[model samples]
Structure formats: structure tokens, C-alpha cells
Target: MSFPIELTAALTGASVNQLRRWSRAGLVTPEIRPSRPMLYSFRDLVALRSVCYLRSEVSLQKVKTAFSNLSEHDLTEHPAAYRFATDGTTVVVWNEDRFMDLVKNPGQFELVTINDVYRSFTNSSDRVVSDFEHPRENLSVAPDRIGGWPTIRGTRVPFDTIADLVADGDVTADEVPDFYPTVSPSAVADAVSFQEEVEGLAG
Candidate 1:
């Protein structure tokens, strides 16, 4: 079922103001009522969760960049599921090969483990947000060690990778291109602008 903006924000741990800003920036546009109230679909919630995962892991700019690569069809029509650690900050989406990997090798993937969430939350002294500063560091270990895409709020990833694609306007949403999926280039540019505007506020 589709969730309203407020529920979507609650589930994603994002502020309504940020959602509005994201819409204005064209990262995750929602259907607008005649009075201009935003109406979000279940797909919108999934997309927002993806954005939240990106933000929690890297930066808001990069999240927007990914959106720019997606056409309206790709952004709104794709059936993506958002998975989060019980802590809430660690969010990942099941998409394409990654989605297949989670299902095929459930015990092997870090993000797909729901068990970890229970363990993490149970041991916490305070609420999860307080501990967002310290996320589960070892997402992947050993020689097979893989890296997660950097998000502004959750993890660190290079900005240039996404910047180059969007700046060149080389990606589209129909099929997964070889370009990085973490963030769309255009979204990155807008995120930069948004960051500047909210430099001092409690964003």
C-alpha cells in the first residue's frame, strides 16, 4: 500500500523539510494535488528509502545525482525494497544483481541480514540516532572485502565519480548504464547547492 508523505518520512527517518527540499531539487518528485499537497506512492516510499540509504551512507548530493540519472519511469516504476539495520541509519536497497546476491547468499551479505539489526538494537544504551556517529564499520571483511557506496549521512564515497556523469549528462533511466548507480550527477550538483543553503541549520 502507498504511504503518505508523513509516514514515508517517518519510515525513512527523514524530515519533511528535507523531503520538500528534495522535491524542489528534483531528486524524488511526488504527485501534487490541486492544492499542491504532495501525494506519494509506495514506489515513492521505496525511492525515498533509497535516497535515505544514500544519505545515511554518503551525502545528500550524491542521492540526488542518482535520481537525475533515472527518468520518471525508472524512478517511479521500479520495484525496489529498502532494508535497514535496526539502528535505522544503515539502509540498503535490493536492486539488480545486488538484489539477487542478497537472496542467493543470504548469510554472506552484510546489508541483507535482519539478525544484525536485533543484535545492534538490543545492545544499545540509548536510542539509535545517538549512535549514528558509529555505524557498523566492517560491512565487508577480508580479501573478498567490498565497499559500499558512500552516502552523505551514513558513509563516505568520492563525489567526483557521480559528479562526472551528471555533469556530462551521459546517463538515463531505461536500462542500467555502466555509470555509477550511487548517485546521479545532476542530483549531486543540486545537493551541493542545497548544502550551501542549509550550511548552518540543523539539517
Candidate 2:
């Protein structure tokens, strides 16, 4: 599913205005929909979030320069097919075939992972957010799932779908199972608590 600009802003650690500016500048644009509000796909989330993370490590000019070089290569792989590693001051792009220091050299791929919403992407070589399977107990995100949004482990129901249900006052933690038999009371609690925790961090 596509996300509205506001939610996209939170996930990317960017303001809506900045995201718009980037889009207009052809830096990172969302997947286009014919008649819908401008919405972002999961791929767009990864790219934009990467820009934010890299910007924190290096200067905006450096990030842009790296992206300028990145645009010159063929990007036929899935948006999250590539991997990266960074120290506080340097960034490198890695793939099975080669490695390129983004600041000193450049490459074609871009992918992201998150912990503390950013470290997993920078410090770990084994994890890719697109390939990620778990966020919390009873929650999973797999490419085969709905846009890879975290979902109730065995079902297609998104974790946020349940969290929003209770947070909106339409249900209680104990009442969730009546609506989704696969979701136990504890899963409901997990969903709500997870949502609260993420929103707090994103805020």
C-alpha cells in the first residue's frame, strides 16, 4: 500500500517540504499513481531514508554528489537490492560483485536497513531491510507480504492496522481476537506498544 506524505515524512526523518523539494529536484521521487494523491512506495522509503542517514554522516553536498554519481549507473535491481556500510565520516556501497566508497568513488545500488532506525543500515553487513523478517514478536515483513509493512506474523493484517484500531478507540486489546482470530490479546498489546514506541522515536 502507498503512504501519505505526512507518514512518509516521519518514516524518512524528513519534513514534507524537504521530501517535496527532493522530488522536484529529481533526487528521489515516489512511485506515481494515475489519479491518487502523491504517495510513496516502500522503495521510495528506502532511498529517501538512506539520503537522510547519509546526510547525518556526511554533508548534504557530499550525499548529493554521491547520488549524482549513483544516478549514472544502471539501477535495474530492486531498490533495496544493494547494501551499504558507513563509519561516522565515510560511506561505502557494497554488493556481491564490488565495493565502492561513495564519497571517494560511486556505485549504482542503494538499499537500507534500520535499528535505532539507522544503525542496522550502516553497521551491519548481514541485514537488508527489504529482506528483513521480524521487527517484534508476532510481527514480520517479507517481500511476499503487503508492501513489506510489518504485519501480524502469520496473517496479512498489518501490525499498524491492529494498533490503529485500538488507538482510535474502536477496540480494546482484549477485544482484538474477536475481530482477528489469529491475533491474541498479547499481539494486540504488542501492536499498540510497538506503534507507540516507533511513533515516539520517529517524533
TM-score of 2: 0.54
Give TM-scores for every candidate, taking all chains together and pairing residue i with residue i: 0.37, 0.54
Least accurate 10 contiguous residues by lDDT in model 1: 130-139
Candidate topping lDDT: 2
lDDT against the true structure, each candidate: 0.42, 0.66
Score candidate 1 by TM-score against the native: 0.37
Q: Per-residue lDDT for 1-203 in model 1, tens only?
A: 44566655754556888888887776677744312467776456555655665577655654554444333224333423333232232233333323212222322334445443322221233222211221222111122222433232222433334334444445442221244444433335433322333343355
Q: After superposition, how far is residue 181 of candidate 1 from its true place, in Å?
A: 42
Candidate 2 per-residue lDDT over residues 15-73, each given as its tens digit = 88888888777677777542236698766766776777777778777766666655456
Name every residue pair that clashes in candidate 2.
Answer: none
Supply candidate 2's per-residue lDDT for 70.
52
